[model samples]
Target: MQRWKINLSVLWLGCFLVSAGMTMITPFLSLYLQEDLGVEGEHNIALWAGLIFASNFITSFFFQPLWGKLSDRYGRKMMLLRSGFGMSIVMVLMGFAAAPWQLLLLRMLNGVISGYIPAAVSLVSASTPKERMGFALGTVQSGSIAGTILGPLLGGLMADHFGYRPIFYITGGLLFLASTLSWIMVKEKFDKKAAALSAKTSMLGNLKKLMRIPQLPALFSVTFLIQFAMLSPMALIPLFVARLHGTSEDLAFWSGFVSAATGLSNMIAAPLLGKLSDRIGSFRILVICLLGAGIMFVPQAFASSVPELLVYRFLLGCFIGGLTPTVNSLIRRYTPDSSVSQAFGFNSSSLALGNMIGPITGGALSGLIGIEGIFIVSAASLLLTSLWTYRSLRRAGMGAEGRTG
Candidate 1:
C-alpha cells in the first residue's frame, strides 16, 4: 500500500477499535442493568438504556460539526489522537460504573468527545486523490462494520469468561492503542489561506452554504430513511430471536453469524459499490442499494425460524452494507475540499438524528404492531425514499455519468 493509504489504514484501525469498544458490550448491557445494577422498576431499564445510547449520540450530534470545524482549523491526525484518548478514558470509566445512570452519563461523555469516524474521514478525504477516494473511504468504513460484526461475539464470549468490566478494560486499552496509532501515523496537508473561512463565516451561513448544494436534501433524506429502517433489525434482533426459541449458545452464534454476515457483505460490497460509484455515479448505486434494502428488510418481519431470520438478515445486511459508501461517495462528489469536514459534520448530525429516532421508532412500531410488522414500515419507508431519491435526482438531471469533480 501507498504511504497515504497506510496512514489511513492506521486511522481506519482506530475507527474500528473505537466502534468496537463502544458497541462490544451492548448485548449484555440490559442484563447488567437489570441484574447487577439493581435497576428494577417500571421503564427504568428502557429509560436508562435509551438515555445510555442516546447520551452518546446527543454528545456526538452537538460535537460532530464542531469537531469537523476544529479538524479543519487544526488537523485530522490530532483530532484522531484526541478522540482515541477521550474514548479510552470514557470506556474505562464505564467499566467502573455503579449504576445504569452512571453508564448513561458515561455514554453521553463518550459521544461528546468521540468523533473517530468523522476525524478519520477528514484524514482520508484530505489525503486521498479523488480517483482513490471512494475505495479508501469504503475500506475505512468497512473497518467500522467489521468492528460491529465482531464486537457482540467477542463481548458475549468475554462476558462469560472475563465479565463486562474486563471487556471494557480490554476495549479501553485497545482504544488507547488506537490513539497511539493516530499520533504516530496519519498525516495530511494544511492549507494556510483557507484556514480563515470558518472563523469568518457564521454558523448559519456555514450550514446554508452546505445546504445549497442541490443534492444535499436527496442525500440527507436517504440517510434518514436508511438509518431509520436499519436500526430496527439491529435493536430487536436478539429479542426477536429469543421469541423464536433462540438459546444462550444460539445468541452469540446467531449474533455473530448475522452481524458477521452483514459486515462480511459490507466488507465485500462497500469497496465494490464505491468503485462502482466512481464509474457509475453515487445515486445509481444509491437507488439500487436502497431499493434492495427495502425489499430485503421486509422478509425479516416475515421470518419464522432462526435459519430463516438469519437468511433474511443476511440479505438485509448485503443491501444496507452498500448504503454508507454510497453516501460518502455522494458527499465527496459534490462538496468542495475546503468544506468537506464541515459538510460531513452536518452529515454526521443527520445520521445522529436518524440514530436518535431509529431505535425508538423501530422499538415502538415493533411493540405496537408486532415484531414482524416493523419490517413492513421499514420496507415502505425505504421504498418511498428510494423512489423519491430517484425522481428528485433524475428531474435535476443528476446521475452517474456527470461526476469528475
Candidate 2:
C-alpha cells in the first residue's frame, strides 16, 4: 500500500478488529452470562445482559465528545493508539472476568478508552481534499462494515470451536497488531501551532462550537434517526433469528449470515454512493439512500423464509450502507477544520446512544408487539429521516437560487 493508503487501511483494519471483536461477543453474551457466570435464573441473566451490552455504548457516549476533542489536541495517530491499546487491554481482561459485574465494568472501561474510528475519521477528513472526501470516508467506513460481516462469521466459528475464552484472546491479539501498525504507519503533519491550539479540557467549548454550525440541529436529528434505524435490527438479530428461523443452530447460522450480508452490501454501496455524492452533493445522496433503505425494509417484515430474509437484508443493506457516509460527508461540509473531530465525536456519540437504546427497545418491542414490529419501527424512522434530508436539500437549492437572484 502507498504510505497514506497504508495509514488509512491499517487504522481502518484496527477499527474493524475492535468493532468485530466487540460485536462478535453480542450473540453469545447472555448465554455466557447465565452459563459461565452462573447468574440466578433467566430473569437476572436477562437484566445483566442488557447492562453488559448497554454499558459499552453508554461509556462510549459519555467519552466520545471528550475523545473527539482529545483527537484534535493530541493528533489523530495518538487517538488511534489510545483506542487500540485501551480496547486490547480491556478485551483480554474480559476473558479473565470472573463475574457479571466484572465483565460489565470492563466493557464500560473499553468504551471509555476506545477512540479509533473518531481518530480515523479525523485523519481522513484532514488529509483528503474536500472534493475527494466522500469517497475517502466512505471507503474507510466500509472497513467497519466489512468487520461487521467477517467478525461475526469468524467469531461465531471461534466461539463454537475454541469457545468464548479464545474469542477475547484472538480479539486482543488482532488489536495488538492493529495498534502496533497504527503507531508505525499513521503519521500526521504535526504543527506546533496546531498543538498549541489544543484545548484538552474544553470539550464542552468544542461541542458548543459544533452546535452553532448551520443546520447542525437538523443534522443531529437525522444522525439519531439513521442510527436508530440501523441498530434496531442489530440489537436483537440473534434472538430474531431464533424466533423466526427453525432451531438454535439455525439461528446462529442465519444471524451471522444476515449480519455479514448487510456488511457486504454496505461495503459495495457506501463508497459508490459517497462518490456519487461527491458528484451530486451529500444531502441529495442522503435522501436517496435513506429512502431506498426504507423501501427495502418493507420486504424484511414479510419474508416467508430464511433465504428470503437474507435476500431482503442484502438489498436493504445496499441502501442503508450509504446513509452513514453520506451523513459524515454532510457533517464535514458544515464543520470548520478546528472542530472536525468534535463534530465526528458527536456523530459517534449519537450512534452509541442509539445502540444503547435500539437493542433494549427493539427487544422490548419484539416481546410486547411482534418480531415484525422491528422492521416497521426501523422503516418509519428511515422514512422520516429521508423526508427531512430531501427537504433540507430542496431548501438549500432555493437558497442558492435566491443568492443568485
Per-residue lDDT tens digits for candidate 1, residues 20-99, read 77677766665567667887742345445545655677778787767767877877777787888988988998889998
TM-score of each: 0.83, 0.81
Largest TM-score belongs to which candidate?
Answer: 1
State the lDDT at 260 in candidate 1. Answer: 56
Off by over 4 Å in 2: 1-12, 34-50, 72-78, 120-142, 181-214, 278-281, 335-341, 388-405
Instruction: Give residue 250's error in model 2 in angstroms.
Output: 5.9
| Candidates in order: C-alpha RMSD to true structure | 3.8, 4.1
Candidate 1 has a TM-score of: 0.83
Residue-by-residue lDDT tens digits, candidate 2, 256-367:
6776788788877876877776676676667778898888887888877777888888898789767777777767777788777568767777777877876666655665
